[model samples]
Target chain A: MAKQIVKALDGAAAVAEAMRQIDPDVVAAYPITPQTAIVQTFSQFVADGLVGTEFIPVESEHAAMSACVGAAAAGGRVMTATAANGLALMWEVVYIAASMRLPIVMSVVNRALSAPLNIHCDHSDSMGARDSGWIQIFSENPQEAYDNTIQAIRIAEHPDVLLPVMSMQDGFITGHGVERVEVLEDQAVKDFIGEYTPKYSLLDIDNPKTFGAWAFYDYYFEFKRQQTEALSKVPKVVEEVGQEYGKLTGRYYGLFDPFEMDDAEIAIVVLSSAAGTARTVVRKLRKEGVKIGLLKPRLYRPFPGKEIVELLKDVKVVGVMDRSIAFGSIEGCGPLYLDICASFFTYGNGKAPKVVDYIFGLGGRDILPEQIEGMVRELIHIAETGEVKQVVGYLGLR
Target chain B: MGELIEIRWHGRGGQGVVTAGEILAEAAMEEGKYFQAFPDYGPERMGAPIRAYTRISDSPIEIHSQITSPDIVIVVDPTLIGLVNVAEGIKEGGVILLNTPASPQEMRQKLGLAGKGVKVFTIDASEIAMKHLGRNIPNTPMLGALIKATNLVSLESVIRLTEERLGAKLREEAVKANIAALKEAYEKVQEG
Candidate 1:
């Protein structure tokens, strides 16, 4: 095992440290709440000459992503960081960058969307961008944020899966919350990420190629089909890279992490930092002889539907906790619940577990252990009675 | 002292409450213990009341939620005593260390801790800071009080970590004066 260099760093600083080690060719960023520290710290690294990255202090998030697209298409390793509104501003270019197949990596510090204008931890930011053709990975803490960042470069640049990757962590919860993180040596990161050899670069004059070409009816449909086909190849590539990374470090990455779920009669399905709290709840419940467990999805995009269905099929009752609301849906559940329900309906073979939708901790509300214990109790009731009073419920809400 | 010790820090934005938490975390890390320190970020301004948190554990900490209940609560700004519920949700037999000129008995009455079973400790940290550093930055002095009250980590380790963390950014005189304030507060903290 590699000697672990433990340091106290927040998620943003940890990601910045990983970026410093990888030392990508270009980093175009604009400051935003919760995510400002990432760029701020990396820019200092640039100023201190710790990394040879071209740091672009862009005007807006739109311009930031645009610069990333330009640099990435030119065959340079590129990355950026942003939160809620900043991500919304980068919407158009976000899709274009992925469709153009630029292997750019980004750190998305998850935050709530605006209307009343709240800047706190929520899955709304990244959840809104789920269909933007980027591979999304959610992290539970600073360590996972750092690990996911380093792994994302390898996954994005994989020849079979040339797609932009978003490594996400809760905004103020993980992004600004400090934790103990074990960082790998700089050389190990360099060897793992390796050099970016673009398959088709705009800068390669010898084999000049056209990108973002206009496609009409006959070819546009085919192009969309090809994009889906490329996306289908992501799961295998992600797993392979995860296994290799696991070999390098003891920390293993997977589509989803299952905790104490082998024979659990009741379980909670969640993402990001909440999973840690759920695990603590699980331990407490387990000690009291409650067969409860937790399932946390690390890879959100490429949804990993089959894996999730297989993991939860045997459970009697499951609660899907989502940090982002899927407004106007018939079920009125959050996005993660919607996706998990859809997955079970498709692949569960009529053995679908009785799943409930829980909208929790939106707008940075605190989700305490007692609240999780309440959810577990509800799940147990559902398992025994085979009845769910409400299909969707809000946790820790007034 | 137990499996984990969670501490909540209350102070104004510019008082270095966040940096104090970070410095303590660095000291705990130096002791080879797992630690976390972060501020509850808001639309921060110079004197706005701010909260920060720190967790020290023999094993790795898994929970990332806000420290709703803490084993120790450190108040770096004396004005925030009644404005914010500094003693809210403190663990039973927890410690509350305050930077104030008032005696612990006076603080207990002012803060309404008559039967809370929580130990109250106070030190004129601002006076100490003013005497040594010529400023009222009570964070370092309050940290010294924290070490005396909770004994979560060694005073020596905290002072050394403070120097390593603030040495380059602060002048040598400022660093030395802060160390003096830390030592004085450590010795002068009083309990009710």
Candidate 2:
């Protein structure tokens, strides 16, 4: 490993640095609050001539993704950034980019979708796109955001999984929060990602291939099946890329990061920035002789259900915290909770832990350490008494 | 985990409170400490009240919530005293630094913090800035006063880091004036 440079940077700036090192052929992006800093920083890099990238300032997130799709189809590496309603705006093309098998990576600074018009951290934006066939990776801090951004490029471009990827960081909380981040040298990053050579290109007139072709009724289902098969290969690619990155940086990653799960009676499952807050409480509780652990999901899409179930099997009571609500779905629980429940149902075979859902931190509400500790205490009560007073709960809620 | 120092900054929208917190965090990192700096983001219009936070420790910081109980509170805009409660959740034996022309005792009386058991320090950072830089930017000078009053980080690192960060966008004379303002505030801060 080359000597790492330590710097104080926010998640947005860190991801921008990663993008700079990758130096893709195209970066077509439209700015939105929280995520605007990312493209703004990258634009500076483009202006300073530090990167050899074609930076296109698009009109909207839809146009941005559309430009990315066009660029990638022409056999060029492309990337973009968006948040909240911007992701909602790109909803149509988001699926197109995935189904077309274009390996365009995006930095999703997660935010809450608006009727209230708030621009802050929440998972509702990405959760709404959970079925869009994009591989989603959640980051807990600026360091993880930097690492995951670099990893997403490899995961999306993998031959076995030519699917779009969304590397996420909580807006304002992680995106704007400045912290110490140790960055790999630019040359090392270049060496790690190497180069991207498309299998077939629209520009290859000699071997002319078609894309976005109409496949109705008979062929549409088969096309979706192929997409599903491609997604199934993501976990393996993610692991391999993570392992390679770890060898270079000494920070190994997996499907999920489990903290003190061994021989614990109770546990909390969460994602993104809140997981860091929950881990602090788990550590304090463990010191007080409370058998509690934390499982933070890193890869949200291609959801690692079987692996998550294996880790939570030994715990008696588990609380899954979600920052985005899946309205009217299974007692109106949050999306992450619903997925965790489905994972337990499909893989646990009647021996899964008693799973509960906690819908928390909606609309960028704060999730304090004390609030997390209270949730843990509730989990302890359920573990000791074997009675879940509440199946679905609200944390940090009025 | 070593002791963590949490600081809260209260200012208006354009007073550079957020940058002050960020610079302190960066300076702490230069001293081989871990730090986090962030602002309470909102629809920030000019002259609107805002707050920012900083946490520095020997180990990595995990908590992502706003600091409820800060060990130090720096008030960059004195007008915020009546508009906002500057000492809502300060810890016992904590310190409160203000950029004001009034002495610390007068500030304690005005804010009704006489018996709060917290240290109060005051520095006329605006005057220092105007004397040196011909402007009223108190954030940089207040940073120097914060270091002198708390010893959070070495003053040398703050100066070097500030010079390096500003040198990219500022002329040499402006950078030197900013440094002069910082040193003046460090020498002139008064404690109650």
How many angstroms is residue A320 displaced in model 1 relative to the true structure, after the best TM-score fit? 0.7
Q: Positional deviation of A195 in candidate 2, in angstroms?
A: 0.7
Q: What is the C-alpha lDDT profile of model 2 across A36-114, one tens digit per residue?
A: 9999999999999999999999889899999999999999989999999999999999999999999999999999999
lDDT of 1 by residue, A1-398 (tens): 66668888999999999999999999999999889999999999999999999999999999999999999999999999999999999999999988888899999999999977999989999999999999999999999999999999999999988999999999888888878899999999999899889888889999999988898886888877777887898988888888888888899888899999998999899999999988999999999999988999999998999989999899999899999898888567899998888999899987788989999998899899999889888888899999999999889999
> What TM-score would candidate 1 get against the native?
0.98
Against the reference, the lDDT scores of all candidates come to 0.91, 0.92
After superposition, candidate 1 runs with Cα above 4 Å error: none
**Once model 2 is optimally superposed onto the true structure by TM-score, how far is the C-alpha of residue A148 displaced, in angstroms?**
0.6
lDDT of model 1 at position A189: 92
Deviation of model 1 at A305, angstroms:
0.5
Q: Give candidate 2's error at residue A368 in angstroms.
A: 0.7
DockQ of 1: 0.79
**Residue B119 alpha-carbon offset, candidate 2, angstroms:** 1.5
Error of 2 at A363 (Å): 1.6
